[model samples]
Target: MMKNNQPEVWLRGALPDIPKLLQPAAHALLQSKEEVFKYTEDFPEALLWEKPAGRASVGFHLQHITGVLDRMLTYAEEKPLSKKQFEYLRNEGVENPEVKMDDLTHAFSEKVDEALKIFKNTPEAILTEQRGVGRKQLPSSVIGLYFHAAEHSQRHIGQMLVTISVLKP
Candidate 1:
């Protein structure tokens, strides 16, 4: 919960200069960031890669929350995925015993910070500008990409929370 005790981000109202249309996205992203930290604060590194019920692992969710935001934001900027990004995508769920839970959660937090910076700089004038996604070049608007980034992170965070609950004693 926010300091004000509000549950939902939208209840916080408009941010200083964020575009009205983009405020919800920013709020959602912030909310997801909060939830990620809350759920993973004491999560065990040993179970980070465990997949109960064949669901995606907590580690995968952590990596993906960061990766998807980066890739989708790149696409929103009308750019193609870099070679490094493709490599990261290919390695999403691979277990790394050395990776601490703090590191994974921190990476996700940093990515959200980066996304917010980009979101603030995005001019409302370009929200409707067309952008291409993936190798197939499917069409999407700037707003569409940004909104998806927020929602997608939330989705994965929800999954991660469930996995954490199941794995934690």
Candidate 2:
């Protein structure tokens, strides 16, 4: 049972109890994509499904989510991607109508799966090794990387939900 008085696990500089943490948010994130992709007889091609005119479009936001997680995982492994790679992933999806929404989701999830496997096999002492994530001096542990990966996923899922609502409005 979660105790109310326990410091919120996310804020603390501690690894979350993963067996309890990883799957639910991951599942929610994967499931929530249905908002963009939808589950109906008449769901349209992702390229043609427009969100509200003023906001970040559905594909762009989804790419941003995937890009962030992919870059973060790469950082965790000490093989951070180049800024160009980051920009390409972050911006490319929406700009091109040819990109398959299912492909994007599947590829992003595949990266997440690799990161999860890394978490399961990586020793705690090693994950705690400090590595700079960009120009910032702030340090992140392996556990923190794991936490960031999952949380980032949920955050974007929420963004997708809003986009879906706006599109339907």
Candidate 3:
């Protein structure tokens, strides 16, 4: 069992103590929304979800990113989810093959904004008890969860950007 103070210690292990670097990750996550719209409806030819070695289609890639956010942020909030919903959207978020970019982008942006707004508005004291994946039994902090969610999106968005380049090239 982890001691009460151990959660912060664990979080610091995966993420460095420097909160300054996190701002860029947050910016990248926000920029991903604009980039999604820019590449899809406005400019389909722009590389947004192209993958090398013949991976998921562009549409699926976009949906995959959204699905991840939905799980890491939405599900983490303890919303009721059907078994199928948990199985497909949260579990196999990346394996699907037929998501339209416009729809995925819109939904993703909404959820991302929702979670970010919560993090921005939530009180410091109340935020500590919020649960995150794998930390349910341990009672994780909301600030850590919020940052993890952003970092999670930012990392995958970076991958999507690269995949787009490969497909475009």
Name the top TM-score candidate. Answer: 1
Off by over 4 Å in 1: 1-6
Q: Quick one: ranking by lDDT, best first?
A: 1, 2, 3
lDDT of each: 0.87, 0.57, 0.55
Q: What lDDT tens digits, residue by residue, belong to model 3 across residues 1-169?
A: 1123432222334322324434443454566665666445443533434445876556555666666666655545655455665676553335333544556778878976765555555555654566645425445555555666666666666666556555653
The residue-by-residue lDDT of candidate 2 on 56-110, one tens digit each, is: 6656666776677767777777775787876776565456766766766666666
TM-score of 2: 0.67
Clashes of each: 0, 0, 1
| lDDT of predicted model 1 | 0.87
